[model samples]
Target: MTILTVNTKAFRPLGVGMRQMIALLGALLGVMLISPGALAGGEVRVTVQGADGAGVEHAAIVLRGPEDAWEPPSDNEATIDQIDREFVPPAISIPVNTRVLFPNQDDIRHHVYSFSSAKSFELPLYKGMPARPIRFPQPGIVTIGCNIHDWMIAHIYVVDAAIHGLTDAEGVWAAADVPAGRYRVEVWHHGLDEERQTTGEIRVEPGTEVDLEVSVEVASRPAPRRRGTVPGYR
Candidate 1:
């Protein structure tokens, strides 16, 4: 067996952008130690709710199986579009090292920046489309904002897991065809005020449905006060 050694100690902080990059490195290390062919097949369903007992949409659900559970997807480059002054989907999930496209479909210009650890970048004042896409080389939560518009914000989650999905408007999501075995699951949301997390081991067999419910307490939002430039384009 070949051994790969990584020196994370050599890396230093260059602001929040490093968060995504660092997360990517951590996830890659996890992947290297995992053997993909050792897992059995199964399915999983996930749901998220607000403190008021309402459904939360577009939240991220990540599943990390055992080293022998399943094969994880290779890190990919991803994209996020800004159209009509809004960030699309409002939230997204991607594998480490994915490149994200920031396309502007609106007539106005936008300034994109992230203060989050997973990754941070700036698409300084641009319109129509950007000259190039931003690349996320790390794994973590990236909260994107429009410098020109305070109300506009979006989140990108970089993870190193075999199965992941975003909740729809109904706050429902599923990661199907998961190999049967034990796994570590995680869920994240913008509305979650504090870090909400739960850890459990579950066994899934072919065609069996596993139901999971997660709770998150988010800071209350004041009734949509028509604020500065409405940020979330799409």
Candidate 2:
């Protein structure tokens, strides 16, 4: 019987090499865990009010930073239904390149149209639902109306910011997990005067909270008159 002698020294380098590879992988994972993309973000709470100090509801608050990127929802679609001769959710905000569906839930048909330069489209006498949705590619305000029902009116605000919030009944809006940086904050409301539409810069720090107060000149616009309900409704 011949006995084979195993050389332990020959396997030493192989074991060392395996240990080194494991260390390298651990270091890489540590770096990845501490990378900027993995860092904790901040939060911003904005409160909007009219000159009279009344809370402004349905106000759009958008934030734009150097790292800001607008990513539409996975569905990339939103719906504005017509019920009770009015557009549900009279105001809405969506990122650019969003497709909006107009579903008429009312018994009557509606002619939805928007002449806004951002997205000019018309659904001629649509009932139930339109065959195709309207795509808003530009960042601007698109006023939607129904030709058949003069009182049916709504506004869609196309914004470039992926991080945005709409003021609630308390006139407060909050954006959480926002990347820490200097951001251009914009507060917009349909009733706000043109001069008050613009807001300035805001600095957000990691793990910190920011509060902002904005006041705007609010104007009263007459609501669209309903057909048959009022005398000489247009």
Candidate 3:
């Protein structure tokens, strides 16, 4: 066999070039790691209450900020089922352009209709599942009701903002992973009187948690009647 001898001096320049390239790549990676957009996000904790200082449940808290370009899940689909002559989850919050399914889980057929300016549609009676889902393209409140059963009612709050949360029984709602920036916060509840909404501004920093407290007025109205054993009877 023939033996080949390696030359050391010939590889000196190549070794120097490789070291320089690695250093340059490392510097670029460092810059990317410290970039502003690469920073961690923050969270917002909201507490909603009524004029009487009682926690308000099912209230919506929406956040609008500079980095609100986020979009809803591509497969986002929500269902509002009718059971026991009432709409399950009386209140729902969804992003604009969301498809909502109205499934009738009750034994009797019911007609679902909404006359809100944002969205107006009617699903004729006789259904387990409609042929297609109802798409809410506009951003506003859409009140749903059954023509036959007036007592069956529900509210859908369509929002353009990417971040929103609903208050729990303790009137606490938290939205996390929000980019740090100035944001406009809006609070809405069904019990409030006409034009029942509150707005405020807040600033969030990187990896920080902000707390907010909001007070709203409650409207005085007769409670909705419960469904009786007979159909169309409340």
Candidate 4:
């Protein structure tokens, strides 16, 4: 009789423990429902190209998240250096509401100016790093040029997304930690001349790889002056 009583007590505890386990699992399920990205387990790779059947390098690739989806990174801001009277790289990407550092690495001063829909601010002639950074709060392409040096020009495309990248020298890029779902990918290159841009609808699944190729019309830009032109000369 005592053994039977003990067994009953042990069974009671076991049943209670099982109920607790179920409750815990339910809580976890609820969390997963509330935040799908938390449970997303997958990877994706993307490759970008330019027009003329040639690879485009240093271009910005932005991935827009689906509606009612997780938030993406939106920090658009980069530095524009004036070195040897030339703009380094000549192009950069920045997220919205970002501050771009403009440090004059040259021996002379530079008057930077941009006329774009996005935020525009000019840095007076100064040598070395500036006292303040320029903040680009809008999402648009800003053309930067030096008043002192008309030959010096650069571009900054302010964007909004965490899933963005710059093409390497080989015109190739790979984005990781991208959730498994539908996304709209945009590729922008300075060389692309098309007014209407190209976009791709991609369904990214976990542990799967997706390859993309984009062709954009290249704008005709004057060849960069190798050496500073002599004063009073065309």
Name the candidate that leads on lDDT: 3
List, residue by residue over 1-234, the lDDT tens digit for candidate 3: 011121111223464466566666768876432333533466678877766677777777888886677776556688999998899988898988889999999889999999988899999996699899999888777899998887788988887788886788777798765687888877766665542353657777655667777767752222565576446565
The per-prediction CA RMSD against the true structure, in angstroms, equals 15.6, 17.6, 17.4, 15.9
Q: What is the alpha-carbon lDDT for the whole of candidate 4?
A: 0.63
Question: Candidates 1 and 2: which is better by TM-score?
Answer: 2
lDDT of each: 0.65, 0.73, 0.74, 0.63
How does candidate 3 score on lDDT? Answer: 0.74
Q: Flag regions of model 1 displaced more than 4 Å.
A: 1-40, 68-75, 193-196, 219-234
lDDT of 2 at 66: 63
Error of 2 at 39 (Å): 7.0
Candidate 1 positional error at 69, Å: 8.1
Enumerate clash totals for all models, in the order shown. Answer: 32, 0, 0, 12
Task: Write down the TM-score of every candidate.
Answer: 0.72, 0.75, 0.75, 0.71
TM-score of 1: 0.72
The sequence of per-residue lDDT tens digits that candidate 4 reaches over residues 14-78 is 64466566667778876422233432423444445443445556677777767634342445456
As a whole number from 0 to 100, the lDDT of residue 127 in candidate 2 is 76
**Which parts of model 4 are misplaced by more than 4 Å?**
1-44, 68-77, 193-198, 219-222, 229-234
